[model samples]
Target: MAISGGRIVIAFVNVIGLALLSCVADGAIQLAGRKHSLHIVRRPRGRNLAGGDPTVFNVMNFGAKTDDKTDNHGPFAQAWNAACQNIGPAKLVIPPGTYMAGQLYFQGPCKGSNPIIVEIQGTIKGTTDISEFQDDGWITFEYLDGLILTGGGTLDGQGAFAWKHNDCRKNINCQHLPKSLKIHRVNNSVIHDIKSVNPLGFHMFVTMSSNITVHHLDISAPADSPNTDGIHVSGSSFVDISHSKIGTGDDCISVGQGSTKVSISNILCGPGHGISVGSLGRTKGEGPVNGVLVKDCTLSQTTNGVRIKTFSKSTPNQASGIVFQDIVMDKVQNPILIDQNYGTSRKKAGKASSQSKVKISDVLYRNIRGSTNTSAAVSLSCSSVFPCERVELVDIDLVYDGTGSTKIVQNPTLSALCMNVKVKPGEHGLIVMEAKVSLGTL
Candidate 1:
């Protein structure tokens, strides 16, 4: 009824070997785990939630009054204050009803400081003129972190009345507009499962933040609506935007200056500027974007699908590690375009700078398939001084509905352009300038 010494020694050795193997597995997990570490929710440990944050916060406690004055922002503010006091992955719950609110300013950084989940069960209608919030700086989240905005509710930026009554309808430089949702210097924030329709200006503008994930969002402004971009990620890093449906007057997703480690996946966009990389030279003396990836996206009936734009007459900047792959386009006006002279109409006054310092390099587009409304499937307008270089295209196919020919407008120094170019009947490849062109079939 007793174990021998030899058996005990063997059991001890076996246990030590198992422990060593577990450590090896942990090492491998750490390498892959770093990418998924910046998630919205912190689970109990060893639970997988890839689509969204697994830690759910219920916002059903926040009551809504239907007959409440729409102009009074007090009830929601009080509720928000109470929710903020009850911290630790808490949700500012808005139950189903018409919740009338005004300019609600959230004063944070909060307790435990984990992301505060604001789940909208019903509509949170803004009361005052959205233009006034833009002018007066009403709703602004400054220097905060761990914030989540979820639920299938809309943040109505009631600017229709303001826009109709404004006197600067005919003026080009009307006024400095504000965005519906503005987050500045907030880190590790996630905005998911939300619909922001008809914002006053740009729907969401992320001025300075990092590790932001925007997923499963539906952003829309009218086709005739002006200055309403779906999502504008500026001056941020490590951003992942996926599962989004955007239709706006402006770009669906516009990556502005000082953004890096950006990935866009599984997006459907239309009636917009499509997915853009720049409009990158305006910054006086900052480095260009680095490590940008766009994959598994669709652009249907859009102005332009994939574009990398810079100014021809601006201070020299540089863009690197930009890639657009696995894209599908349908009835897009300009399926693919790269414009060096990316100035607004205001540039007609004069060149912003004497020479263009913006250097475009390592830009690659691959596996793009779809039909375009326009003939120019691919257009490159790189700067003369610092042109686009190291460009590659693999498995590029454009079927133009047998309607017209696809034209290729080249730049001065397209340093490298490689592709397997083909189109339907009556379609031909047109190159305005000389570049290294490789033609073959996939």
Candidate 2:
């Protein structure tokens, strides 16, 4: 009846394995703890989209109005409203004319038995100060099953002057954020092949949605535009964004709080803050973000390539299982960054309320090959109590243009590291024992 060491180890391993398996099963079904009751692939189109049937509705030559350049709202709104309401398996087509509208909203139950595709050939022209922007939600989709928006046309936000008006000197309380499109609680939606330009605020904001796929979309905003994140996804799960080009004032992709299972690939970002995990915090109580993966992306002239920022004072519910792999950085400020203490003000930081609560852990960066303009290529700073655990770096080759102190700084929290880090001539890569971990080498 003697318990040997080997048996004890085996028993412990088995228990851990079971726990992991259970977690995977739960995540696979529920999807990042959102409890979203939607499935990715729909059934076809017999009565209830029975076995993956394709349903196409065209919005062409079916009651459209004409508008002059001076008039911004005439035919476009008429066509969109009509098609969105009348057609089954809807396709709100914008044919090759300049149709104008103030604001458009895609209301509830916008789905049929088959996958819905909204094809556009013309454009959805927006008005600057029609006063409808204040009232309209600009394409709001709620609780829909599946949506496909494929078009060669554009959705012009006409938001430059509106943005300036809101940013006036006197109107400090003006909350004029002009978003091109907004989607909420939609499951398994696809928005692609479309051009979105000059959004007043975030180009596309996805909230409380799941299993969304955004591909081949081109989003652009002026460099000086404030709060103009290309794609701002919040409280969503299982998002796959790929093969897209985004350039904006703020982060190209800002994964806000309560977002998880985010997989991004083949993205080209420039003239903006690179893809980010957070600026996570602000509200009194909040949820965590986990299971984020970014790979095979390219960044150019971006402030930073990969970043995770949390407030120093605000208590983070949980953040784990984040990874960035196969990234190409071009003139990026800092290719890798992890800041645990994230928030606006450092004076009021949140505290960890309980031990059972989750913390940021298991962040990995691998296969990052690139060059920077004149800055550190890697920087990581985690929480003091629950320091980033299991931080790994494999096959990372980075170089600076000049001798910009290519060195690696080692810290206690940074354990189990394999830095094959190198830099240009006259630069030093070293491990500096500073307030946080700084690992650089040549």
Give each model a TM-score: 0.73, 0.72
> Which prediction has the highest lDDT against the true structure?
1
lDDT of 2: 0.61
Model 1, which residues run further than 4 Å from truth?
Answer: 1-64, 128-131, 134-139, 162-174, 283-287, 344-355, 402-442
TM-score of 2: 0.72
Top of the candidates by TM-score: 1
Off by over 4 Å in 2: 1-63, 66-88, 165-176, 341-358, 402-442
Q: CA lDDT of each candidate?
A: 0.62, 0.61
Per residue, candidate 1 scores C-alpha lDDT tens digits across 64-168 of 475545543666666666656654456666666666666666657666345667777677666654533525333456666677777788777765655454433
Residue 280 C-alpha lDDT in model 2: 70
Tens-place lDDT per residue, model 2, 134-202, is 642565566677777777888777677766555522443356475778888877678889888887677
Q: How many clashing pairs does model 1 include?
A: 7
RMSD of 2: 12.2
